[model samples]
Target: MNSRITSEIFEATAEPDPEAGLFLNVATNGLAVLDRLGLRERIVDKGHRSPHLIMWSSTGKRLGTVPNGPARDPERGSVVVRRGILHHVLRDAVREAGIPVTFGARLDRIEQADAAVRAFFADGRTADGDLLVGADGVGSPTRRHIDADAPSPAYSGLVGLGGVARVPGLAPTPEAQHMVFGRRSFFGYLVRHDGEVYWFANVTHPAADRDALRAVTAEEWLAVLRELHADDPYPVPEILRHAAGELGGYPIDDLVHVPHWSRGRVVAVGDAVHATSPSAGQGASLALEDAITLARCLRDAPDHATAFAEYQRLRQPRVEAVVGYARAINRQKRVTRSRLGIAIRDAMLPMFLRKAADDTRNDWLYNHEIAWQGSPVGGRR
Candidate 1:
């Protein structure tokens, strides 16, 4: 079988600096997919083990501890790695597999016939295939090609900024990430064994203010963050103070649902169909799950249409559930200005955490395993 990957970038390469790009928390479920693909060890080697999330209030009160990955296998928990490193690992794996990757081939439109599909690129090039899978991310044009009425990505009303910094004298947060619900923002950071801190801050804002947020300079954003986290507990302010090198910022967005995942010979996967906020840290993992599932569907199903239908049917519910879960977390991370609300949250959070821990509520998410053996039981729609 022949496979090809088309990317919009001029060159298919990852950021050279290890700590330069966004950090991804790849849950065990995502690691499981990489394990299936024989790349799990490579990813784990490049990342820090993050199995737990320790929550805290602005007043330095430890809120509670939550498991970040499945409790069943404590040894193999989530791994936090730089996005660029993950990309490099996956890209190298693809190259080793001899898959042809065509960089700078931005899709302009899709033309479909009874028997095949053609992707027309902006560079006056075209590629024919039996089916076209759109992994083009949240702003996927292929999604529109499948269904012009597909829902646009909705802003989560939170502005996200993060960077890596080496803060001396900081103790390593082994196997955990610390989350602080600050007075005006949410700050999360994890220190590697080497004392390098990977940190991010989420500031609440109106969706309409995205353009304004984007217009702010990196230095300006850093200043804003310092102010927001000024009165917060230890390390947040310090992390911001020492932050250097490419600080990334964006308005966090998610697609609650896309009505059409596929049309004719075209199908959408990953953020194209279902996008979740960064709160749950499952966005990358869910995309990995989609890749494995879609491959299995196409391999086992008799035809492309059946494969697409089965893939959507199997995946839509799981991804939507995850999105809902992340949305709930996003609500918690939003700035709580009311003292009463803050007090109430702080008072009730321990109980909530206890209940969640007792019941192992997130097992469904982190423990998800893709079984690639059987053919899908759905017929052509």
Candidate 2:
């Protein structure tokens, strides 16, 4: 997604480091689209997992043991991607681009007027821009500084536990698998290329009290995870048995509403504007979409004001739809003693999946692109 969007505004930064991350499943599908467009070359073993640049020379022999699950369609031949792998790959590529990337830097203030934005950082220096995009995460400093009263993300009454498990001969058939048992749920998929099985489960009960959730000792946290997955499908127990104490927990939250996503010269995108639940799996994809769309809008509009409007015009409906869908999915995960309800809910998934695929295929999105000429901000048309 980032590759597709970035190519529209800038030259290919570097051939995509496919080996730097896990590539398999739906994520690879999107990546393959970019690769086929000649924007990148898929690399093998790009060296992820740490900053140490370790390569997986033993991948070939261990490849057969990989669990290809239902979530992936071998027929589609899409790339499987891991969240961490994408982050590391994109982070390294961005740094190598000489595009002035910064980490751990804090923004202190934002001043915007006359179609320009100046962001002041804690270092007592400021970066001025013809356009400013708040690609920050859910607790966006830009959103707060720009609109203190803008809608905030609220806990969606759920918590998620995620981890990677290595169970030697227990590979799943197909590519990826999602199992919703009662109100709780589990989603597992094999990341292609990297050869690891990653899974996440949603627990909607007990709506973790943030303070209590964080207060638990490491041992207590593991106990809680085991308790949550006790009734889940095969190997969930075994997966817990080998679980690394790396376990962590956080309350899930979503933006119920946001009156304004852009104001004056400052505009917000992604989680900063509409943070949806992970149950939707569109959070990162949506954010990447925002970055590219914002660039395109600013490039195509007659001026900053027009571009801002165009940005909202193109994104609002799509974000709202996802937010609504996310909330609805959350409702399903909260099931309790509702057998009839579960049956009906299960019946709706196929329809929901179809709609989601259609949403991505819509012309207003996925198909939108901007030419790679002119300044990053002035390349309209």
lDDT of each: 0.83, 0.54
lDDT of 2 at 321: 77
Steric clash pairs (candidate 1): none
- The TM-score values for the models, in the order shown, are 0.92, 0.71
Worst 10 residues of 1 by lDDT: 5-14
Q: What lDDT is reached at residue 170 by model 1? A: 92
Give lDDT for model 1: 0.83
Clashes of 2: 18
Candidate 2 lDDT, 1-381, residue by residue in tens: 122222201112233343322222322323433443342343224311110100111111111111121122233223334545655556556666545565535677788878677888776767777657777778888788668888778888777666666756565433334343423344333322343455555666466577887786657766766776666555565566566644456688898567788788778888888998876555665675566667667656667678777777776777777678778868766655566665565555545544332232322222223333454421111
Best by lDDT: 1
Give the per-residue Cα lDDT of candidate 2 at 202.
62
lDDT of 2 at 348: 57
| Model 1's TM-score against the true structure | 0.92
lDDT of 1 by residue, 1-381 (tens): 213334222221223455545798999889989998999999899899998888888899887778888664557679999898898898788788777677767788899999988888887988887778888888888899998888898888898889989888999999899999898899999999999899999989876465676688899988889998999999888998899766777888998878788998889899989989889999999999988888877777777788888889888888998998999999999877899988888788877776443356687888788876564432111
lDDT of 2 at 300: 67
